[model samples]
Target: MTGTGLDDERAYLRECRAAIRRMAEGARLNVVIGERVAGDRYSAERLGYDLRSLAKELDEQPDGPPFFGRLDFGPGSAEHHGQRYYIGRRHVSGGPGRAPMVIDWRAPVSATFYRASARDPRGVSVRRRFGWSREPVALTGFEDEHLEAGQDLGVASRIVAAEIERPRVGPMRDIVATIQPEQDELVRAGLEGSICVQGAPGTGKTAVGLHRAAYLLYTHRQRLARGGVLILGPNQAFLGYVSAVLPALGEVDVEQTTVDRLLARGPLQGDDGEAAAAVKHDVRMAEVLRRALYRRVTAPPGPITVPDGSYRWRVGQEEFGAIVTAALREATPYGVGRERVLSRIVAVLLRRAEARGRSASAAWRRGMTRALSAHVDAVWPATQPEEVLAELLGDPASLAGAADGILTPGEQSAILWARPPRSFRSARWSAADAVLLDEVSGLLERPRGYGHIVVDEAQDLSAMQCRAVARRSEHGSITVLGDLAQGTTPWAARGWREHLSHLGKPEAELIALTTGFRVPAAVVTLANRLLEVLTVDVPRTRSFRADGRLRIRETSDLGPATVAAVRDALGHEGSIALIAADATLGPLAATLRAEGIEVATLDDIASAARVTAVPAAMAKGLEYDHVVVAEPAEIVEAEPRGLNRLYVVLTRAVSRLDVLHTRPLPAWLAPPAGVQG
Candidate 1:
């Protein structure tokens, strides 16, 4: 293509941008005159919100282009035959009843843009990928792949390759332009089914999960809107890093949160040892909580008596027992069971009144319901989740009764509170305890459910955490994303089978994206050395990015070496991250600043500094173009799962990894073993 061709592509882009502006303008002009438009104030507010949401989607993207690729359909295709369509993150149309100027990448017709090949063109004549000037996006170039002979799938377009190998900066960006065919398959999978993507670093599993969420919302808008969609990340930082992906794809209704924040039911002023936390997060704890909660409900101790119409009616313990038994059988949450108990007792008294010719009106029922409150409380004492959890954790007697035959003696002691608080209000709880409270809350009162949940870094989720995620997805499905080999928590899943079983989605399809385009082949090979030692059986990932640089520097001074590496890394394009043990990060940051180098903390993704200092514990879901692993031994020795932690740290680099080790570098991995550079 010549300069004229480039100019033509730019013109098309301009048209698409203009179309979006007009659509937004039309939305802005749409006025809902309160009751006149929607008949009610609530409906009118809803109408206003919808209009604002639509307008926001069409607003200008300061730095990004509206569309990234284009597809020309063959004459043999369906309605779209012999037509050219621009593919973008969101749909942009001229007006009502008008064809879209830019079709959403999630649309069915746009699937060929990602999946077309010579062997299986899917009626695509030409697939074109656009290259943009990074950041404040401007069309720089474009490449075309005309499928005529054989599948050139193995040969990637230069534009796609450049986009894949492009330097990563700030927060993680949507990889819509370079989403591989394998990833697209997982992304476009049916919303009815859950998929567990077990992929190594740089496989774009996180992006696939986010895009799948956006796609599901686009395909099944009304269905998902009722139950809603949620994206759960390992930490708030991770959530922040990937927060823009969904909104960039024109989705704002979907929720992004952490498991801790989602399951926060306690004061959470407490801390727990890893062993204690592991015990609390065990699946057995669910049974323990259930038992503790239900034990308060028992057979009626005495007769139930109520006074009505100058007459007294008395019911025996035996008769009350029958009603209680039936109520227990039908009761789901504790509150429902209590209500049923009250209703049955009230019904018996009301039946006697009706036989005497007294009406069973609404007033009569309300009076009976209130009159039987004391008896109902006696039969089944009303309890809060905190009350149940506090008693179980603080009282040895309660713990023994609930955990009998469920948790071992050692496990019981591990979770036992040494000094109990005076009451539930004064109780201090750990994250594990908070999760337990959430479980108790579910058993007490049913929580709301979501249409779909995407849990990233799922391998680190404990049995109890999986259950929390599962409860939100009873009516919906889930998209589980993680690398089992990277599981670094004390209670991390040994395999996806166990993880999925805990999530209550044992039937979900498990997909592995072993071919990566983000991390370099050289970096992957070096990281693979640690995989052999992992308890789980994980396949080594192949990286199409064959040009990653790996440098090993063993220096006597750890701080000085890391500072030097960051200095050199600053000379490169894209973001640089210096990741090491959590304990060493403080001194390292101070040393870097002392040496006249400005260091950005991992939390500040938007920081202008070229280099960011990261702790290995916080590097699970982050990536950088240039990464400096300060000391492999320090990262591996900081925790019980240090080797896994080091694996995560080593794989954070997409373009370059410099291992600055004062001590040994994992002992097994030879220096510069697979350094392509």
Candidate 2:
């Protein structure tokens, strides 16, 4: 098996598949094939015969008939129609090189199978004859099959299926099974009203999302042949990253994008959507309000409050600027009164909404009008009337448009949110495409112009953000994924469901992806250990032990013992990562660098490095070889923001772990004290 040739490999594969098929039949076991891009690879050999038996299945049949010799395109063939083509319901022609193409397994004449043309290969055409359709069935007995593989007069043969089956398994595995689940389950769940999967970090949230897409395509191949779903990835990198998952699962590719990309298409895309002028108008209003709030808050007698109570405070006015300059000169790490004033304005609008029979948004607009009228009367003594009103309610659209060209780097900070991209609009504004927002918790705002909504990483989203997501989709299902322990968003509060009432979503459908499939039991153990919250004054440590089997190793060092622990972990195989809470990034990075150890910032590592040090904040959505929590105490006491971050960092370690820290470890992190090696 070491260097088997292709034909030999094929024979071995055939034999193995036959054996697995027999085992599956005997056990009434369903097979879930993993990593199935090509049909040539073997089934399994490691992780014990029983576990491997359940790991995957390799079908002897090619992706299609054998006559075509596997029609899969080579890497990078997605462009030029060499590979990847979209098959819409009515034969939509041509798309990105990465789009999916339809392959017909059933044809009256094997050679007459139709494929969408490379460039508008509009109609079906006969290609070549395939062989497998005419081949006769080959049958064999289970004992004979096992004997052919030739186990020498073996010791009592292992009860490959019987002895290995565990009736009651950990809940996490159940979740993983459901997340991607078996194909039949996928078919059943796909058409079911709505589905929700709340996956924590390392829980394969994105993986399940991709699988779900494929499942829909495979089960409902006819309906999905046309565009039936939309995928919203977190960003472009993510779009490219998870693109292959669906195709691997035999799914027709659907649309994928970011929220900004979707918004561009929502109301701004066509005649049916909002006209560009109206969009521009809103842009202007946003700017006018921004400037009005800036000026109103910086006036001589402190800040000004409008009748409805919306107020503004300037961050860089001359007097306050001077105080900040003095403080910076004194190297003050802490500053006071940096409250975002416009948010207060929004809150005031909410308060006024309760007073008047109007929505908060409507009341806020009325309040702004009243505030401008009052500002005109008071400020007219010193300024011209036109200038006063103009400054108070500046033209935001013109300002925003101009920002595209003339604004300086510092002044153009808001430009990123200025406008939506154009491709996201529906051809018909009312079409409720099944919408999926991957890593939904991180979206900046609820996407506009969607009829239905689905979200992943719900736990990481703040309550307010979730509400925003709910507001964007009208009369559509909202599916979310999250893990309570991996709540990395600094602003996110636990129990995001509490805000579901505000968003108008049902609370009963909340789903949890509790399976620990991506990370081993050891990694989960380490993360849960550091994250064990106290209930009724008792440490919730026992909750960490999901199933006692550790597919991966777990390691740790209490506070004040990290440096030595780091030194020891460094001596092991594989790279290391040191995750910290504060500005300790640069210093510890430099320190580790001085020791000739590889160290990198979390942002940098997020983009490239496999094993490197990083701050907890930057380590979200990523993992590492051996992760070291530099200051668990700092995370617990001074920076609660880092607690979720620490959870993310610890889960990165697949085979090993090293949680280093200073000061005594918190009750959540203390190893069973003396119960050690």
Candidate 3:
């Protein structure tokens, strides 16, 4: 009914499937790539099997519609520089033994027939009988998001109106829990524009996002392999938490990465010596500042109050003026502390600028700031004044020394840093892809590339962090998932809805998962009081038990309190996790274990063990039977930063939860029925 004739369609399908088979075989052969095969002729000798045999086997499949196989190699080939090669195949996830080297595979559908329909079969009459068609018609316009979704739903999935649906594909209600009728409808609403999902805790933001990704893959199968999809998570720990969810929905393994790793490896690793030196110097400067700030020196008000109250500090005008005067006067016969002054002055000025607004143009700000800094060296001790430069000059020696942590000695020696490389090493780029940074919000400073950026904690990301992610996307699609009310990141300021207007974000769709999946209705009561802080709808239900498990205690020592909580969980044969605000808490965990409480540290729990406890933030996507929230009181302060951490901890528990504290709970932590023990 669809094509010219039955024989013609069959013949056409045969040829198309044959080509796919040939491609698959070629991919499986593992012909040495790179310069060896980059431009070399693909003669029969280079190929392991006869093209005719490979094509014939694919055409002999008994299925109603043939399947397709897809493979990819590292950057090298003349065609795509790490391109995907497709062929019709019978199975997906072919065992490691069957096809150890192959990348991925999918089944064939209407698109395959349509694209192959036009080509001349030559002696292969099946293709000639069907007649000729250019590319796969159905898959032409679909983006990466659509293609990935389509694949998950099924190779036969299609786009009806804007939504991608596969009637044949089964729903994942068992693993995913209840399916919100609204969620299915939301994903199907497929607008040509972008959609931002505004959700609350346990609202299935992640579930919906993944379903959409699968729908896209299934509906747009042809381009799905190439359309890179990126998922950006909160941090490395969170990245690992949700890594397997995509495969569960039948979508391709979307390349996952964090914004920080992207920036560090992408553009930050400069091409030339000068660029490398500049980057290295900036890194050193940042490190030095971090160390000094850790010292927490409380000096007198020398004209300007030291900037505080945020991530970065700002210097005052008075302090700036004083430093320059001293540098100049000290430069007289005796050498002046110009270098120290330069560092201190720059630090103070940046701190002040970061705090409050300065009445000046961007250019004027840079000029004035640079002028003041430069003058310090000019009026100093020696006859020849030292020069103060605002930006670091990328010097190779300095870069080599600075790169000790990131690069190996052999790598440093092999790659010439005197000047930029005309052609970048494919290995370097490929190697850099391994480290995934989920707390993408932390690395919002600049852009690099995220094959596909899926922002898991959207509401927890600030405007600056969003902008940073936008810059990082080189040629991939971005997927963001979050509930605005669940925001606990210091950087997440404005509402998640504001992201559209602020970032000029693409057409975003709003999907509300009305059902609460993680917590029971009784447990929901505690978080309901804090729901006032969020703008999204958070329905309460008695889904989980309110075991009078939450307790606030006032103990003189946090260590003993943590020990007591651990002892309590272990007494019940329950797994216990002790979490702190940051890595600084690493020591706290160690000290507690020293007290002979069966405590688990972050590193110990992060591995393969299932019954282990982790920090609230680190435990973002993970769920446990018994969660002992350590230092909830410390995180419950009215301070914006503290509130975010507190929120993160409160929402982490699944069935049983205990809030341990060294002091009385903060009023901010208490909701309607938050009991004190």
Candidate 4:
């Protein structure tokens, strides 16, 4: 390309930026005018909210380009004949009488930009990719692939490589400009379809999931907005890491939360063994809870009597017991059945009055129903989730009744509290208990469902947890995202089929993304060695960028070596993470701080320090530019499926990785010095 060509592209970029500014300004004015012309208080309030949301969407990001690629179409195309279209994150139009200055990447016409190639032009004549600096305000360079005959398409795009290799800073950014053909297929997948992405580490599965959410919002805005879209991550740290991606794509309404937060019950206190927690999280626990809850509906202790004005209605113990038994046989939830039982008792009294030649008014029946409430309350009480779960864990008789033929005596005892608390308020609940409470809460009352849910790190969710998440989206669809190889929990899913069935999305289409764009080739290659030991058969991922450097250091003084590694990593341009075993994170963070190094723990959400000390377990869905692993052996020994955890720790690096270990690396990871595995 010559100077004239460069100048022409620069001028076109400037023109496009001006158009975007005008479009944003016009949108702001429309919202302001709408707010002023509101007819009532409700309309005004709604207009204000819409205005705030529009302002967020139209807000200019200083470090982001309005458009990334431009396509020139030949004559006789479906839309825009012999016209040029700029594909960008958000749509921008020229004033009223002019054509659109930029087309949204999610638009049908712009699909050619991402899908077209020399092999298949798809009506596109030329594709141009503009390169920008980190700030993305000015066009630094341009690359064009001409599809006309006798014209070279040029070598592979340096701009694409540069964008993929961009240094990591802050949270993950939108991959709008650099979305691969495979990723675009998933992103453009219809809103009604549920896709389960089984991607290897660094394969950009999380990004693909978020982008799909944004795309569906764009395509089915009103439907999804009414039902709502939710993104479920593993923890707060992971949620905070990817929170910015959707906003950057002009989608601000998608809810991003964790399973525990979404369940919204209990403080996650108390403890349970792995075996006990697994048993509680089993799908069979749903039936056990059902038995425990309905057990509260026993036969009436005595006859019921009600007084209305000068008349009294009496129901014998046998009749009342028969009514309760019939109501319980309805198989409805306890809360719902209790009301039916009470209504039936009132009906029996009303029928008796009619048979004796006495008339009962509507008001008289209402009065009788209220007067009989005390007897019904004593027989079939209204129970809360926490109250029932507490009884199930504390009382031996209730446990045995609910667990009979379902759980062994040892398994039942494992879940029972050694010293039962007096009440629900005094009881401590663990993470697993929160899931059980969610299950019971759903049974008592129908849970509200979202329009769509994106479950990230889904393999780590237990069967009960999946049920809880599925209940919230029972009427909608789901996007399940995770790699089985990265599963670290005891109840991690062995297969996507079993997992999706628990999520109530058994027919969801499964998509595998085997090409990695985040982690470098060398890092993923080293991590893939663990696949030999693990039973999972994940495909080897291909990296887009050059191989990153991997250095292994041997040191007797672990603290000093880790600190030195952190200092060395700080010299890089992007974020640095020092990963160690959970037990070692506290002391290692303290040691780093004591050495005058500013370090932030992963749990500290408020801190944005460049150097963060992350535990191996919490580092599942996160990535950093430079990573320092303190000890490989400790991470492998941390849990039963520790090899999976170590694989996750090793692949977190995007630019470089330094492995500092005082102890010998696990034999599976590090073979004999002279012999290669």
Per TM-score, the best of the predicted structures is 1
Predicted structure 2, TM vs. truth: 0.44
In candidate 1, what are the lDDT values of residues 505-547, reduced to their tens digit?
A: 9999998989878999888988888888878888998898878
Give the runs in model 1 whose Cα sits over 4 Å from its true position.
Answer: 1-4, 32-36, 96-98, 149-155, 672-677
lDDT of 3 at 133: 19
Q: Which digits, one per residue and each the tens of the lDDT, describe model 2 over residues 1-677?
A: 02223454345335434543454453333322333332443543322333433333223222321112112222322333233221111111113352222232221111112222233222222111111211242211111011212321111212212111222111111121112222223223433345555555454565555555544554565654433566664445445545544443333346666544553323422231223222222223333322332232223233344454453522233443343234334421111111222333344446655666655566556666455444323421222222322232134553444444444433434322233334222122221111111112112122343433445445554443444455554345444545556565454436645545534565435455554444556556555665555111111222212322222212243332444545666665444567776665567666655666555543341433334655666555444445666665665554545556556666655445555544566566656433232
Q: Candidate 4 lDDT, tens digit per residue, 512-620?
A: 9988888887777778777888867777777765758778777899899888888888887899999999888889889999999989877666776889999898998
What is the Å distance of residue 627 in model 3 from its true position?
1.2
TM, every model:
0.96, 0.44, 0.47, 0.91
lDDT of 2: 0.40
Alpha-carbon shift of residue 43 in model 1 (angstroms): 1.6
RMSD of 4: 3.4
* lDDT by candidate, in order shown: 0.85, 0.40, 0.44, 0.84
Rank by lDDT (best first): 1, 4, 3, 2
Count of backbone collisions in candidate 4: 0
Return the number of clashes found in candidate 2.
18
TM-score-based ranking:
1, 4, 3, 2
